[model samples]
Target: MTKTNNIEKAYDFGASEFNRKMKRITQERLKRGLPVSLDIPNDATPEELEELKAFDAWTRDGQPVED
Candidate 1:
């Protein structure tokens, strides 16, 4: 497979795994009657998009911790 194809696959897997974990955590927090929060922007600037892309790359590399 091409490099681009491999990158896409890695990003997809990372995103899916992230979503699954987030959903589980949210559910558990709700069951406990605790507040859970997410900071998803409705509109993103070019810099923000670039930063997000970098974060995805980090996640793809198996380093999902946010700084």
Candidate 2:
């Protein structure tokens, strides 16, 4: 007896979620700037820590790490 199942309703919900995500991404892009490239140390992670142990960068010395 229920008639709540409808394609239009499903599409409306999906579109609403998509719009919300789009807005959030746009805001972050503006804050961080677009086309950003990250150059991290080879030992950035636990796995990479060993590989990059010998490698050193003058810029990273005593500087806080940013992911």
Candidate 3:
């Protein structure tokens, strides 16, 4: 449907823009000797990706983590 297509397009555009900003921020941080927030490698495995997702879910978007 047209609505689904538009939503997918919006998601793709947002994801692309986010990646662009992250890459720019990462580059600037590297130039300034600052630590980057994300550090997943190009060859990351499924387990690594899942771990990252779980970690993000627990720590991001106002999600509370138990001590």
Q: Pick the candidate with the highest lDDT.
A: 1
Highest-scoring model, TM-score: 1
lDDT of 1: 0.51
Clashes of 3: 0
Q: Rate the local accuracy (lDDT) of all candidates.
A: 0.51, 0.36, 0.46
Better candidate number, 2 or 3, judged by lDDT:
3
TM-score of 2: 0.29
Query: Comparing 1 and 3 by TM-score, which wins?
Result: 1
TM-score of 3: 0.37
Q: Which lDDT tens digits does candidate 2 get at residues 32-59?
A: 7664222467448853443233222211
Candidate 1 C-alpha lDDT tens digits along 1-67: 1134345322333355676565556556666888866564769886565555554444334333332
RMSD of each: 9.5, 19.9, 12.3
Q: Give Cα distance to truth, residue 26, candidate 1, Å.
A: 0.2
User: How do all the candidates rank in terms of TM-score, highest first?
Assistant: 1, 3, 2
